[model samples]
Target: MFRILIVEDDEVITKALCKQIETWGYIGKGIHDFNHVLDEFNEFDPHLVLMDITLPFYNGYYWCTEIRKTSKVPLIFISSASDNMNIIMAMNMGGDDFVAKPFDLNVLIAKVQALLRRTYDFSTVQNNLEVHGAVLNLNDTTLNYENQKIDLTKNEVRILSTLMENSNRFVSRDEMMQALWETDEFIDDNTLTVNVARLRKKLEEAGLENFIITKKGIGYRIAE
Candidate 1:
């Protein structure tokens, strides 16, 4: 059975959508923590995600990009924002389909079925990033080491993803910020510093001391 994760903010909509998804013989889980949607995502480990465009703290695009980093799971954007720009942005941000609000339930179901068939029919092994006996489960954004599983926030996941993708190579701060912030919003330099500090602290606590090393004035890297 397939599982769908609904990231809608409306209580009625989330409940209704989950009901319909359940009726379709698939399990549905609704995200409760808007501030930490990724956490719920990792917990549920849905096959498909039903997301809205606008959300608290960050938008659907940010989450979509974040999810894309770890998994190729399909996502459909269900929102009242149905303009051409919104639709195009949704696709650009990795949405498999877009269902405008005031949409037909039958049509939404058809799309959902189609995307599930297309995405999961021929899936491959999930990838992980391993370094220094610490393994990062890309699918669920968890770091495993010494029999301990450390859940990673969206930002921390992206940070580790980028660094590990270029393992042994320094990834500059600018590159990481671009990877994290695909939107036009300006992010302060201190924000990156804060995120990296938190990530480093987590690694240290997990017994992987100096898992991520600063390259002087360059950037950071995970040594080979």
Candidate 2:
């Protein structure tokens, strides 16, 4: 049975959501500490998350990005804020689906089941990219090197994958940003720099120093 995490702040609504989720034959868990959403998320390792746009400490977008930092678990937004911008933002933030408030419980279940099928049914999916001794797990956005699992954000995963996949080539900043599928819409060159710096630090910690080379004025690449 798949576990579901409910991040809704409404006491009565969350209770109902959890009860409904259990009736569908899935385990439902909620977080008491709104500030430590990720803590509960990492601990539970739920297969899917039901997140509300409105919360106590932070909104759903913030938590989505936080979860996207490491796990690519299926996330469905559940909130009354069902505007066009919110839907687009949810998609951009890696949410799998969205359901507006006052929704039918069965509809939510259908979406969750469909997403689960789409995500988990791919039995032959390439979950890892390996170069040298380092392994990058695409599913969870983590780097495995020397028996260590180093967590990576979504941006870092894209950057590293672009370089490694291209092999002996310098990937330009524009290309890097484009690799993420939303360059101007979300990130800039400076943002790329920060992500690369953080990725390099994590890589170094995993004992893979000098893995990425700077082409200065051009872009970056993995030394051939």
Candidate 3:
């Protein structure tokens, strides 16, 4: 289930939003310590964030900017300040959408649903392996990671996708070879090792170091 972080200080509003989030079949968490908002955000690792403009210590904009530094998770601004300036500022501060306060919960839920569907539905509807902030678009055999992109050969894509799909589990050499051979001629054992080594180097260059780990004589695993 997708997890959302609520950064509203109002106890009543926080509780109500959490209940609404649960009813909509999403996980929700509210921040209790305004001073350590970023810490709470990292710990939660939420898929989305709902933040208030005016806050006790640093305000929503500050926290939103902080989240942008490490992740591309969607952020939505919720506040009583509905002025154009606030909305514009929210977008400028890395918020994906804005929800004005004193609003209908159903309407808010609708917005949330649309955002979630737009962001996540397309992937689930199509079975794709995603990892380390990168998406392996199975339809095209392309790897999209943030702003950079790479096209993969059929076998290379299958190998990486399988390892990524079963991340943290050792993918035996035999299993990998079987997957590779599905589309083309049998790949020699050394060929698989070479491909994996190259893939690991590429991932490391893309800032995903230790993405794949070797088990010496056994197999390879996507490192946890």
Candidate 4:
């Protein structure tokens, strides 16, 4: 089932929207800590985001751009502003659509369904990995961090993907070698070490420090 993240601050509206989502056969998650919206967002990995223009901490536009740096997920702005300027600004901030507040539940569901169909129907399932604000794009083998994008090599991609998949679990050197063995290239001990070191350097250069932890004799892991 597709998951939707709702960032509306109004408790009454959030409750009503959650009901509408369930009625339409979709799961809905409401934001509790507006300060950590992105953290919850990364954890939930929602298929689409319903954002409000006016928020307590940063506005929806700020979060939308931050999300756009790493994901192409659909973002729809929902606010009572409904002004032409707000609509245009939302679009400029990479919002897929706009839903004025005090809206009809049925209409909101319809717009969400249409956007979901348009986005995911023609694309592969997106990856949901993050480190220092950089997202590993599994579908395209790209690393996006702070709006800067980088192409990952096959070996680099595998190493990072494996580490991210088991973020809190220590992955032994042998396990990493085994992961590399699945590739077309025959990997040796030196080759695996070289690739891993290179990957670490790349991640570090991208503003991620101590991302991959070495568990002395145990293996490696991305510290949660």
Candidate 5:
């Protein structure tokens, strides 16, 4: 199912939007932590975003710019600021469309459907896995943490993806090896160890010490 993230602050409006969105067979979530909008966005990995211009900590344009850095997901701005300047600014800030406040629910849904169709028709939307503020872009196999982007080798990506996919749960060595085997590379026990060590080093260099934890004779998991 396609997921939509709503970044509005008003409780009533947010609830209404979510209800309307879900009624149309799409999952909708609202942002409760205004200060961590980007964090929520990463965690939800929504296929599209409905953003408001007026917000508590940072405005919609700021969050829009941040999201654009890593994703090309369709974003629509819904705000009371319907002036031509704000509308143009929304587009310039990477928003795909603008919907002024007091908009008809049907019209909004139509816009949402149109953008979703236009954007996803030719491409698939790959989601990012986020744990402890670290975002792993499945589309590009890169890691983003604290404003730093770290490139990962193919094996490193597979290892990290497996661990993060089962975050906070032990992933046995056999299971990890199985994940790596999908790459059709010759992966032995020693190779897994070396790849994990290298991956851990990269995480640590990015200030993510202890991001992955190990248990003797067991396996590894993302730190809880």
Candidate 6:
């Protein structure tokens, strides 16, 4: 089932929207902590986002811009401010659609279904891995940080994918080598070390110093 995230602050509206969304067989999640919108977004990894223009801490446009830095997921703006300016701003800020408040819940559901079909029907959905403020784009094998994009080689992509997929814990060298070996590459201890070293250098150049931590003989993990 597709996952949708609701970024509205009003408890009643969020609850209603989530209940309606789940009825349509889509998983819906709401943000409880306004200050950690992006963190919640990363954790939920929603396929689509329902954003409100008037949110606490930061507005929807700001969060939209931030999310566009890492994802191309379909975003729809739902707000009381449905003026021409707000609609235009929403589109310019990377929103795929806009739903004004006081709208019929059925109409909103239809719009949501239409957008989801239009977006997912024609393209494959890719999820990005985010650590700190840097985002790794699995679709293109590039890292985005501080508004800079760094391209990665195939080996680097494999190494980073492995480490980032297991960001919660240490990934042993043998496991990493196996990940690389699946690509039919000649991967051994020395090759893994060189690839990791190169990946680290690239990360450091992008201002992510010590992004990967080594635990002596245990394994590697993304810095906490």
Best by lDDT: 5
Show where candidate 4 strays beyond 4 Å.
124-224
Scored by lDDT, model 2 comes in at 0.84
Clashes of each: 0, 0, 0, 0, 0, 0
Error of 6 at 111 (Å): 0.9
- lDDT (Cα, tens digit) per residue for candidate 2, span 1-224: 88999998888888887888889898998889999999999999998999998898899999999998777788999989899999999889988788999999888888888877655543236777888888887766678888898887667888898888877778888899888753223787777888899989988878899999998888898876
After TM-score superposition, what is the CA distance of residue 156 in candidate 2 from its true location, in Å? 0.7
The count of residue-pair clashes in candidate 6 stands at 0
Per-residue accuracy of model 1 over 1-224 as CA lDDT, tens digit each: 99999998888888888888889999988888899988889888899999998888899999999998877678999999999999999988888789999778778989999887644442234468887778888666689999999988667887887898788689998898986774223556798899899999998998888888888789888966
* Candidate 5 C-alpha lDDT tens digits along 83-149: 9999999989988899999899889999999887755542354467789999988655689999999
**Superposed Cα deviation of residue 17, candidate 6 (Å):** 0.6
Worst 10 residues of 4 by lDDT: 119-128
**Tens-digit lDDT track of model 4 for 125-201:** 54557765779886556788888777777678878878887886899889998878765478987898899888888
If ranked by lDDT, best first, what sequence of candidates would result? 5, 6, 4, 2, 1, 3
Q: What TM-score goes with each of the models?
A: 0.55, 0.59, 0.59, 0.57, 0.56, 0.57
lDDT of 3: 0.82
Better of 4 and 6 by lDDT: 6
lDDT of 3 by residue, 126-161 (tens): 657777778888655567787877766656787887
Q: Rate the local accuracy (lDDT) of all candidates.
A: 0.84, 0.84, 0.82, 0.85, 0.89, 0.88
Model 6, residue 182: C-alpha shift (Å): 38
Candidate 5 clashes between residue pairs 3 or more apart in a chain or in different chains: none
Candidate 6, which ten residues in sequence have the lowest lDDT sum? Answer: 118-127
